[model samples]
Target chain A: MNLRDFRNFTIRDYQDLFAKGELVPRELLTIFLERIREVDSLLHAFLFVNEDRAFARAQKLEEEGRDRSVCPPLWGIPIAIKDNICTLGIPTTCASRILEGYIPPYNATVIERLEAAGAIILGKTNMDEFAMGSSTENSAYGPTRNPFDLERVPGGSSGGSAAALASLEAPLALGSDTGGSVRQPAAFCGIVGLRPTYGRVSRYGLVSFASSLDQIGPMARTVEDTITLFEIISGRDERDSTCAPYPPFSRAEIPQEEEVRKMIIGLPREYFSEGVDSRIVGTIEEVLKGLEKEGLTIREVSLPHTSYALEAYYIVAPSEASSNLARYDGVLYGLREGGEGTLQDMYFRTRTSGFGAEVKRRILLGTYSLSSGYYDAYYLKGMKVRTLVRQDFERAFQECHLLITPVSPVFPFFLGERTKNPYEMYLADVFTIPSAMAGIPALSLNCGYVDNLPVGLQIIAGPFQEGVLFGLALFLEQMLSLPLPLPEIGQQRRS
Target chain B: MPGHVSLEEVRKIAQLAKLSFSEEELTRFFQDISDIIAHFEKLNELDLEDVSPTSHISWSQPPMNPDEPVDWQGSDLVLKHAPCAAGRYFIVPKVVEKEEKLS
Candidate 1:
């Protein structure tokens, strides 16, 4: 096997070559490191690249002369991790100045599983500060530009991971999705991202945003690779109480094609409301017609409380964020600023200077919502709306096997377009936020292109229903069969 | 826009969040935050008095792990990330200073 462009290689491609003795782990690692050095400066995808560690790991694996047949599934394949997920001995900055030099003493459980599967940790990618913003512009390290169009923003907070994959910096990546962080970025970059059911992937090491909504899952160039990583990282962990007790997920668990084809796809009418771009709706409608022609049924469904999802999400996420982020008070970990007199003064100054604008905005919003006079009105009301949102999904699923919607209402916008308008940024998450509130499994696949930018079609399933989600994604992957070409970083126009 | 939050309220909220902002920033935040809260007011249109708030969607009681102690190997490593640490303890400014002598 002659590997021409290593960036084009998928997990299976690399595995096949390794098993055939035509390729080795060390050579693959070298290619990626070289690729990162060449392209990453333009993308700003990675915050820290562990050149020495990755090379050493690869050399060690090669020296072992390990039998490929008996090794872990991801043996020798390199994967990037979002900066928020902790990596032992590596700084997990969450793209914030507060954690500039902070390093984790232990790895997140998902990291442990990835290592056990023999996947190489390439490096940590940039994100919205503490995963608070729609675009990665909020990142303290500066924004990760879209590889497809240098002038536009890559939908974030997982923008770096998606950009990395789009640029062929890494074959696979892991990112946390709290209200479309993973899926939105994936859509913008023309890759695949899955947010497993909450508790499906252990959250033990993920830095919390909103504890209830945060979930870490896989991002890759293909459905097969996403499922492969998902199956490996999923399962219960003692450290995270919220981790579900479900048995380990596997390839054998996916529903058969016939069963998947028989499934009814629901198009939530609320998701197709007025502000959504006509081009996006046009693309989704075309895909729906194709799916119907393929013997699958499509039906109009109503998720009545959908309009309130954003409101509820804003309240709950920031409320929890305000509570969770209170831990970074110049005490145990992260940055510390001096106080003139009191410990409280240190906390005030440290947090004020350390956090970025979006982060501070959310913190204030959260703190106000959960504060004494407003808790009952804002936070509690948001919680009730959350219940209504979940109920809406519950009712919708009763009529259909799964739900399909646009990942974002519009295509990737130009960088700085929505930076000044916070409301506009929040609206980007409208369609994806409901499923997140419901704590269901959702996957984004590159369905079509609006102009030169790729448009993603999201498929959401009931809790612990990743198997069905994967099956539907696989069917769509085969049916669409669209060639996803790598984006030229310099080009910012229609292809 | 019915209930406009004043600058004083914004200050109180910032204080609650352990954050401090410049006067100009506070003014801008007040407007931005008010607009956001006005959007959130859409929730008041629905009658959800009977609805039980859901903190999480899962109904299953999480299975608790055995209460046995496990060895922790990262104490020193964790301390290494602290901005100021004396041995394993994190150092902070004095919270309670000597009472000022009566002037």
Candidate 2:
């Protein structure tokens, strides 16, 4: 098989590629390097690419793992880390000017897990500044263009990771989701992305966006591949007190009920809102019909307080962001002042010169919202609404097993479409945030395409129910047969 | 009523947040803050007298493990991209200094 076939092979298919003696890790690394050289001008998905380092690692893996039980799970498996996540040797710019040359001295917990599994680290992928915007347009490095349409966005914060996976530039990648960063981008880029129950993956080295809300999750071409990667990286680490101890079902224990009568799905009415695109809604309805034809039960349930999730999220997220981001002063970390001035002058120059306008806007809003005098009214009040949102899901789960919704309101829009209107752009996350707010496992998988562009169906379950979530995602794959292709915009330049 | 915040209060908060803006930008920020609080005011109408307020969803403060200082002390070559280091520690200029406020 040549490089085209090499790029297309999933992690599962690679074992055979290795067994056949026709392809090896070094050759695969060269293919990805060559592909990036061709297509990355249009994609702009990566902040850095390390061909020599990646090739060296792959060569070491081939030499060491050749004949020993010392075989590593991801030995030579290529992975791209979202820029916000730190690697000891590589820069960890959160795609903001403040951290233009900043690098962490240690690996994030997720990166440690990936390297332990022997995955090859290719380079840093672009993301929204401090995991902030919905379009990735907020990156100081510039936005990552969707491989499906170079003129469109890859759907942000995690957009670079999603695009890299979609274009087969990497078999697996890492991204962080505070609200919908992981799922929405994966949906737009047409790949499978999992936002595990908050804290399922450790945030030990993740630069804090919202301390309570930030989570690291996996993006992949297939659901089983996502599960496989999630399993390898998940477990309680003493380093992260927030990490939850839970596991998705392994490949060996995948359930096949022998018939259709055993399956059940719940469609919450709040998810089918007024402004959602009719085509996106129609695609999900078609999937529901197909599931029904297979003998599964479908019920329309009410998450009575669903409308309040987004409102609550904006307040709480910014409030926490306001506090967590205060650490990036000119003194301790990140960009510093270059000229002689007062301490105050140094700080003023450093911050004003450092952070982007959107990030500055959030910090100001958040700090004000959480200040002593307003805490009870705004910050504390938003938390009350947050509880009601979680209880609404808990109450709904009592009635149904799985909840479904469109991952975003519409398909991928042109890159600069709604960025000038941040409010309108924030709306893309409305459907996906409540689950994150409630700390539940959610998955986004392609359901159908509109104008040949992909739309995703999200599967959500109660906290720690990732096994159920993965099962539903795999089941949807078995049931949907349309040609929902990966991001194909850069294919001409890729080979 | 947003009795806790005013235009002057927004300026103070922006200073704490480390963002410097012109007088015009400050006015715009105050207006937006007022609008957001006005929307949040709708929640105050609810009779939530007996409801409990939540601080966090699933967070537990990290338990302190063995308290030995793990050595970050390395030029270590691992932190090659960070430009601000002196020996084993990350170096930064001093933070607070006496200042005069404008009258």
Candidate 3:
């Protein structure tokens, strides 16, 4: 098949072809690998491509398909995994120098499930070092540029996974959302990203950022494809103590006309604050209008603690990071920098040389917040504020079924615009953080475009309400009916 | 921000965190950390006296699994990535030299 045909096909489309024996898995894998080789150089989306292994798996699955009565859920589908998620023998670098050559000893639960579903593991995608930054610019390997306009960034630290989907390097990708990592990048790339309620997905193999807020989510070109992958990868794993020990996620049937008419979408006033770009506000209003016309109720709600979310997140996330990253002391696995002194010297030099600037900056910030004298004043206080943030959602949800807002304050910014200003970069996550702080599920989908950059509308549901999110997202998607197309890669270079 | 962390305090933090930076780098970090701290200070404006901290967001804890050791099928894979390993144990620099005195 040609590039356009391959890009346009969704997971279901490929599955139908596979079931009919119309398309060969090995040939499709070859096409995808060839396309990735052609365009990945410009996109910088992947950190490691498991070409030989992926091809082998595709061939094996193809051979087994002849004997099977029913096709597996993700049969023949190639999926990209964020580098932070372990993949047994595959290199799982968090786009950091410290874990440059670290190969995971066991597959993440999600990887095992995908393999069981007969999915081909395409490669590991790039991300911000240690998932510490908003833009993929913090990636030690290099930034994953926006395929639409090369000068701009693909919002991150899940930027590479989103870019991989948008660039057609993979039909589906997995990424961890600590704060707005998954949603924001999905927004910027004009695709669907679902951050399941924290604990909905097993975190056994996903590296921790802020353990409480981190969730492994799926990024895909369409809502159905995203939900399909979400169902396969989500469940309780004994290895992750915090993973909810609930039954396998069973999505409720799509909402009927009466159900759709009864749905109430809360518009949090704090999300449309002055910091939001006028164009984005206009796009949101247009969507609200569309929702209203569809007979859904739209009401204004207040999330009083919205302004303090970024502050609370910076403190909470970094504080958790400092403790989590202490394991990379250069002894067990990953890079080890040796010197001429004691064991202390080796540790000091190893971390110093191994970490990038952004990683170090967060480490210092976290260490300071959790230090002996300041723990109460900083880390504890941040947690209290986090409670207030969650309470805001609880109160707001009392009056509405789901909250609707812009995924980011503005459309994706040009690369380097906010790099020098850490606080400004943090603000890019303002709209999405409150829901994440509440441990609720939220999904981002393309609503419209601003100056050729995609603007995403985020629909949030209370904890474990991913079913509602999917139905509503599909509803909004059909209402908007915006033309989704692959990026004309390698054309623009304004940067 | 009500607090100002001096370079000595930052150095102590680095030591606690098992990290080190040059003098110039420490100075830069001092300022950056201060700026971040200042930004985080906005959280102090809220009255959280009645609010309890949420360490984890799970609604209810799941029952614990039985404690049983699983065979280490991953020993070789884990050892494969180690920078320095002898047998199954990771090797590291000497903690105490023969002639050097403890600090």
Candidate 4:
């Protein structure tokens, strides 16, 4: 198959070809690598591409040969990984100068699982430095542009993974969502992303941002593909104490249309409030109306504490970050500066030079909040407010099986538009934060497009209810059936 | 709560964070952090007196794994990435001054 045909092929399509002996893994890898060579200069989505390793893996898979019945799932599949997840011997920079050239000696549990399933690692995709920002613009290397429009951001810090999938660089990718990193970017890039329930996946080798909030989620072009990847990487891990004591997700059959019609979806009133763009609200409402027409109930519910979620998140996330990021002390690994000075000076200089502006800002904010005098007032209070936020979701779930909202408040903004204003960037995640704070499963799927930019409809379910979440997503994916053509890149610039 | 984050506070926070900033950057951080803190004060408006803080979402305690020692094969590889190392020990600038005597 040619490049165009390759761009349209999903994981299943490639598997079908492999089964028919019409394609080899190495041939597919070459096509994707060639596309990356031609397109990545414009997108800057990858920090490092494992070309040699990928080819070796693909050739090995070819030699092993595909067995129709016994071959592992995801065999010969090329997948992109967000830079934060550790892959042994590969540089996991988290798109920060601090970790430049620091190759991990161990693989994250997800990486081990993916490789065990016969998936090939494409490379490490770019992200905000330490996953702090909502835009990839904060990346120390560079930003990953939106596939739909080169001038706009592919909402971040998982922007690269989303952009790669949207641009057809890879069919499956992994991203860590501390806040809206995965879902917002997925929405902006017109792909599928999920933030599974906390503890649903192991966090053993994934770099920590916020201990309570960070989760490695799967991203793909379709909900089914996303589900396939999610099942592979999720389940209990002894290494991660936080991982729930549950088996890997069993493939629950997607509920039939009749059963789906019986389920009720709640629309949080706060998500559709004044701050959200009217176009986005309208686009999601139209989808809700269509669902309503299909004999599904769409009830308006209240998440009163939603207004305080962003504030609490800013406090809790940064506080955890300041504590988690203290390991970079110019000694063990990563960049070091001013070696001849005192240990304190070496630490100060290394951190000051290695960290970018946003990272330092968060570190300082967290330090101040967790410092002796302010802990109760800031960090403690933030946690209390988080409880309120979770309660709001619990109450809403009592009235409905699922909740739907816009993934982001507005369309993907142009590059450098919100870079100067940190608060403005924080507002972009307003819709995704409440669900994240509650630690529930949330998925972003393309529901419609406005002004030529894709609008995402977010479906949130109670903890461990990812099966239900995927069912709704699959139903909507069929209903919308929006043809996601390969983006024309530079050709579609706004005149 | 408004305009309460002073330059001294920003400096202290930076020091505690082990990060440094120029005079100009310090001024900018003061303004930015003050604005952000002011926004955070909005949370105080709600009465959360009875609500317990949620440090983690799951209420169940994590089950512990057996405490067993296992050989780690990556020791050499781990030390290889260190900026300064001497025989498995990471080298660093002196922590204690020469005049300070050990207790």
Per-residue lDDT for B97 in model 4? Answer: 88
**RMSD in angstroms, candidate 4?**
1.3
Per-residue alpha-carbon lDDT of candidate 2 for residues A1-495, written as tens digits (9 for 90 to 100)? 544564445676775566566668898788778778877888888998867788898998788755435556676788999998888767788998888777677788888888888888998899999999888899988899888877788898899999888777778898989999999999998888988887678888888999888888888888878987888777677787777544433554445544324656789888898889999999999999988887788999888767677767778988899888777766656788757756677778888888886787778778877887777777877788778878888988988778888899888888789866555677789888988888787888988777767888899888767777777788788678544344456443333
Question: Tens digits of per-residue lDDT for model 4 on A1-495?
Answer: 867886556678888999998889899888889889989999989999999999999999888888888878899999999999999999999998889999999999999999999999999999999998888999999888998899999999999999999988887899999999999999999999999999999999999999999999999988889989988999999999999988888677457778888999998888888888899999988998889888899999999999899999999999999999999888888999965669999999999999999998898888888988788889999999999999999999999999999999889999999988788889888988988999999999999888779999899999988888888898899888887647876777769
- Candidate 2 lDDT (Cα, 0 to 1): 0.79
Under CAPRI classification, how is model 2 graded?
A: acceptable
DockQ of each two-chain model: 0.73, 0.43, 0.74, 0.75
After superposition, candidate 1 runs with Cα above 4 Å error: A1-8, A493-495, B100-103
Interface RMSD (Å), every candidate: 1.4, 3.1, 1.3, 1.4
Q: What's the lDDT for residue B4 in model 2?
A: 37
lDDT value for model 3: 0.87
User: What TM-score does model 4 achieve against the real structure?
Assistant: 0.98
Candidate 2, A270: how far from true, in Å?
Answer: 0.7
User: In candidate 2, which residue ranges exceed 4 Å CA deviation?
Assistant: A6-8, A67-70, A245-254, A257-261, A484-487, A490-495, B3-6, B28-38, B59-103
lDDT of 3 by residue, B1-103 (tens): 2467788888988888877788998998888777777777677678889999876687547759989998878888788789999887888899988998878
TM-score of each model, in listed order? 0.97, 0.93, 0.97, 0.98
List of clashing residue pairs for candidate 4: none
DockQ order, best first, reads 4, 3, 1, 2
Clash pairs detected, candidate 3: none
Docking class of 1: medium
